[model samples]
Target: MPISSDHRQYWQTNLRYLAILLTVWFLVSFGCGILFVDALNHYRIGGAKLGFWFAQQGSIYVFVLLIFIYVYLMNRLDTKHGVNE
Candidate 1:
């Protein structure tokens, strides 16, 4: 069966959200943790180097936060698409 425009748009929006969230995760985990580690090291967080913190803990925290954000976003999207339980 053919897909309806609304369904296609819904999936597109979902993919866009996933792309954006994953990009953010990548930047935080790789950018701050590796690429900018030296620069970030200039700052301190909780007595630890900012970059080190990101590499060791910050990425995990951000990932968890992103999961929550994704859940909230998906809930809204589901409601908007009339697919919510």
Candidate 2:
């Protein structure tokens, strides 16, 4: 049997969110932590340079934050789509 339109829409919305979040995660993890490390190093984060902090700590923090945000957003999406549990 074919999937319903609502199910398809839910999956599409989820994929869109995943793409956006992954892009942001990548930019924060790789861009700020490495590619733009020199520029970010100009700033300080407590005892360490900003870039080093981002590479070692900030990326992890951002990833965790993104995970929570994804959960919250998905919950809201589920309610909006009448699929909440």
Candidate 3:
């Protein structure tokens, strides 16, 4: 079956947003948590070492946050495309 133009546009927009969000996800997780962990550990937030927390827990938290953000954006896109269900 042929897909409608609206479906194609929705998918394209979704893919673009996914790519950008994933890139930022990777940078925050690996770049900040692992690569710069030592430097980050010098800083403290709420009495815990920032980098340590980021390496151990913060990245995962950020990932979950990103998921919610992606979903929210996707929902908005769906409305724009008249594809919400």
Candidate 4:
């Protein structure tokens, strides 16, 4: 069976969301944690180096937050696409 235009658009939007979220995750986990570590290290968070924090804990926190954001976004997307339960 052929896919409808709505289905194609819905999947496209979903992929866009995934791409954006994953990019943010990568920037936080790898960019800040490694690439920009020296620059981020100049700052401090609760007495811990910002870069170190990102490398150790910040990425995990951001990932969890992103999960929640994704859930919320997908819920809205599902409703918009009439796919929600």
- Give the candidate number with the greatest lDDT: 1
The per-candidate count of clashes, in order, stands at 0, 0, 0, 0
- State the lDDT of candidate 4 residue by residue for 1-85, as single tens digits: 9999999999999999999999999999999999999999999998999999999999999999999999999999999999999
RMSD (Å) of each candidate, 1 decimal: 0.3, 0.8, 1.6, 0.5
The positional error of residue 47 in candidate 2, measured at the CA in angstroms, is 2.0
- Model 3: per-residue lDDT, tens digit, 13-75? 999999999998898899888899899989997788988788778889899999999999999
Error of 1 at 10 (Å): 0.6
TM-score per candidate, in order? 0.99, 0.95, 0.84, 0.98
Q: What order do you get sorting by lDDT, best first?
A: 1, 4, 2, 3
Candidate 1 structure quality by residue, lDDT tens digits, 1-85: 9999999999999999999999999999999999999999999999999999999999999999999999999999999999999
- The best candidate by TM-score is 1
lDDT of 2 at 47: 82
Error of 4 at 69 (Å): 0.6
lDDT score, candidate 2, position 62: 97
Candidate 4 wrong stretches, greater than 4 Å: none
lDDT of 2 by residue, 1-85 (tens): 9999999999999999999999999999999999999999999989899999999999999999999999998999999999899
Q: Give all candidates' CA lDDT scores.
A: 0.99, 0.96, 0.90, 0.98
Superposed by TM-score, candidate 1 places the C-alpha of residue 45 at a distance from the truth, in angstroms, of 0.4
Residue pairs in collision within model 3: none
What is the Å distance of residue 52 in model 2 from its true position? 0.5
RMSD of 2: 0.8
